[model samples]
Structures are given as C-alpha cells and as structure tokens.
Target: MREIDRLEDELSPLPESITRIRKLISTLELCHHKAERWVTNIIEAIGEGDTAKGLGTRTAGELHPAERDWRDACVALSAWCAGQPAASVEIKIGGRSASCLLSKLGERSALKEWQVQRLIERIREFIGWPRSMHHGDSVYVFMEECGADFEPPGDAECPEHYREHEEFWKQTMQTRIHDTVNGEAADFSLAVAIDVMFPCNWNFVGNLDIVLGAIGGELYAAQPLTVCARNICHVPIRERMQTVCRTLQCSLQNQRSENDVDSTLLELLGDVTAPQRWLVASLDKTIRLQLRL
Candidate 1:
C-alpha cells in the first residue's frame, strides 16, 4: 500500500490532465450525439423506405455531408482522448520547450499530424500559454488558407464618395459640438457623439464604455453603451478609421484634458497625442483653441 501511494504521488498531475481531456471528450461526444440525432431525424423525415422521385432513393447506409464531417471530427477527437500518454513529454509553447502532460498527449494521440498540431494549439490556448511567433504564423497561415476577409481598405481603392461622406460626418459633428457648447443639449455624452459621427463602425457603439474607461475621466456614466473596448488599442486605426476619427474629434470638441486623451489614445495609437495634434492642426483655429490644441 505504501508503494502504491508512492506511485500515486508521482502521478499526482496526471489526474488533472486526464480530467481536462475527459471534459473535452465529453463536449465532443455531446456534439457528435446531437449531430447524429439531427441526421437521424432528417433521414426519418425523408422516409427511409419511400421511393419518392423528388425525395430521391434513401440509401440504408448513407450519411449527410455535415453528418460525415461531424463524425470524422468526433472520431479524431475520440482517438486523441483515448491515446493520452501516462507520462509527461516535451512540448514547445511560445517558442520555449517544456515537459507537460498535454505535450505527452500531443505526442501519443492517434490523430493525424495536422490534427495533432491543431489540438496542441487549442490546448496551449486553454492553458493560457504565452503567444509566440509560431502562434502568429499559424494564425496568419490559417486565415490565409480560410480566405479571411480582413484586408485593409487602401487609399487608392477607396470610393471617391468616401471623402464626401467623411466630410458630411465631420460637419455634422461640428454642428453637434456647437450645439453642446451653446447649451442646446447638456446631456450629450462623448459616447453618443462618437456613435453619431461614426455610424458605420460597429465597435464604437458596442465598446463605448470601454473606450471611455480607457480615456479615464468622469465619463464612467457612459458604461451602458454596448461592447467592451478594453484592448481596442491593439486594433488597427486603418481598419476602423471612422470611429478613431470620431473619437479624436469628440475628445477635441469636448475640451477633454490632453492627459486623459493621451492615456487612452496612446493604447490605440502608440503615440497618443500625434493623431489629436494632427486633427487639431487640420481643423479651424477656433476649434483648435477650444480644445487647447
């Protein structure tokens, strides 16, 4: 019994790894079961023994394309769960080599090479592993292979009317600012101003509170907008220029402190003050002075 306890002590970490794998397997199995049930219902609806012309001849052993894909994925996941090694093995994460049970599972899984690689990536993500160049490369390659539609709009390719539309929005925002200054609308929040000006940007509306939080001021009341903008600085301004422009314009129009604007915008733009400075310079002198730019 003492020897058995010693073996159990040595394998203490193994149980957690096995539990994780089991949870994943259970999820996959549930999905597979649901898919199977759905496929069975569809086949039954089509009438198994019916020879209806439009319905087509129901084959006794045929599976729908979706069902086939789900089945294959289930099979692959099952094989992986069943083949977990009893011991740890070497694995690379974020370019650093480490010995872990998951790495052992990766090495031992009966899944194909590509399947194993994908599984390892998922496990690494689940374990909160630091991202490496390999992770970036893998994501880039996958996006490319999957034809991800994330290409930035080029200046040359932009519609001729885009400038006109932007100008219209700018004028509208300026008018709104004037109204706010004249006490026409005392309740105008910066979030509302941004949303109104950059109507095309989805994130601005959803992440208004997040953006406001990043700015850091008495604007905490703007928290009930939509999406969290916590890591929006990491997002490319070029991808969402309308929102970016609106934010800068709104900040300037409201005479928000340079320090506050800088703190937030810097996260989105490495040099926070640069965009605001440029924006101020481009605007009328009256507007520039009002913003203390």
Candidate 2:
C-alpha cells in the first residue's frame, strides 16, 4: 500500500476510480482473514482431539475397528468442507490401511519430523500407499556427473526447439544428487536432492539451506552448530560468496546418490535474489547477507 502511494505521487498518478478498487481489496482481505482464522481454529481443535466440539466423538464405533479412530478425525474436517463444519475429504486407499504409520501419527514423539516422514515412506513400501509428495520438506541438489552429456541452452542449430522449454533445459544442465536416507530399506528415498548451480555463485545462500536441512533430516539428533560472520567487514564479499558455494559443492558431493546417479533436478527456477550470472561481477551478494542465511 505504501509503495502504491509512493508510485501514485511519483511516476504514475492513481485514477479517482482506484478508491473503489482499494475498498474492494480491503473487503477481500477481511474475508481472507476470517477464512484463515476459521481454518486455524479447526486445526487447533484437531490437535487438541476435540474434533469439532465433540461432533465426531459422539458417533459410536460404526466404522471398521481398524479405521474407526481415523474416521473420527476425518468427520470434523468433513463437516467444515461441506458447509456444516465437517471433515468432508475422500481419501482413496489401495493398501491394507490408510497409511503405514497411521497408528503412530498422533503419538509422534518417538520419531523426529523427518524420521516420521521417512518411516511413512518406508511403511508405504511395505503396504500400498500414496508416497509423500511434499516438496517443501524435500531438498533438491544439482551437480555435473563425470563425462556429463551436456547441452547448452539455445544451441545455434536448435535454438527454436529449446525456446519453449528453455527453463526445463537449464534444470537438465546437471544431475540431481540423492543418497538413501535408510540403508536397510533399498527402496527408501532421501528427502534431499542436491545439484550444482555454479561455481562462485552467491545463490548458494539458498543451496546451503537445502544441504544443511537435508543433513539435519539425515542425522535427526545432530549436534547444533552456530554459523556467523564475526569479522564480516574484514572479509571480501566475493570470498564469502565462494565459501558458501564451496560448502554447498562439498555437501552435495558428500550426499551424491550411490544407486541413482542420473536423477536430474526437476526444479525449474533458481534463486533469483542471488541469481547465477555468467559474469560473476553482476551477482547479487546483498540478498545472501541481508537474509542472514
């Protein structure tokens, strides 16, 4: 809003009709806030096991004994979605149960968040269940393999062919790295997928986050370490950027896939704030420092 006001005073003046749009925007904001607040209340109620003010609990155990408890929780969510405040969600299950670790989901203190995530995947393998498709929890790593069959984007001969899928081509530039989170379960997958973006790229501020987060997921009870730029003023920004890039490179290599070496980074976008540029001088170093990553 402040930026819009500044722009109106400077480069472009707002038309008198914009006042109506502004009012409409405020109304939309209020409606959004109310919806969010209602959802939050439902989520908290579920966490507390209230399940919509005892609406779900009052129902006797009519569902299959195996899934009775699960149905109880779903009832609240069904009501909400159906406009009667219910857990109106239909989940397709092809396996023995809804999920492998559904029994332990509520009492989750035994496992770390990542462990639960991994165990869920492992259990799904044993039984037929939909695999976890959480992109936020998963890390993506990119790197070049030895004798990598590389193709530069917009190759002189086929520039037109690459135009539509240019971003996809860039993502295909390197193989994504992944190491199994579980040694016992061969089919088990890791949450991290590492790939090399470039050397001397400040965008590693985000890369390191993926690496560290993956490492944390792997070693659930890892010892905490503090990273800080104590003598940041004395250190050159270029050198600092290189340090981040090097850390990321080493970590990605350390976690490189032993089984599947051909996993390419499917992520289409790079960190634009610390963008990878052919020329290092144009890199946005401030984004890395400003975010304090």
Best by TM-score: 1
Provide the overall lDDT of each model, using Cα atoms, as 2-decimal numbers.
Answer: 0.30, 0.27
Query: Tens digits of per-residue lDDT for model 2 on 1-293?
Result: 34334433552343333332222223221112132233223323322323232223336534433233223223322222233311223332222222221322233232223322332332233222232324433332221222221222233221343345444333333222232221221111122122222111222222223333332333231211111221122223434334433333322344333432222220111221111111111111222333233
RMSD list, candidates in order: 30.5, 25.8
Q: lDDT of candidate 1?
A: 0.30
lDDT per residue (tens digit) for residues 1-293 in model 1? 34334543554554443333222222221112132232222222222211122222458456554333223323333344555342333333223222331332233422223323333333233222334425653231110111112212222231343344444323322221111222222233332233322211224323322322322232333333322222222223322333333444544455444432333442332232322233222322322222222
Report residue 34 deviation for candidate 2 (angstroms): 45
Clashes of each: 4, 22
Off by over 4 Å in 1: 1-86, 90-114, 117-144, 149-250, 257-293
Best by lDDT: 1
- Number of backbone clashes in candidate 2: 22
How does candidate 2 fare on TM-score? Answer: 0.14
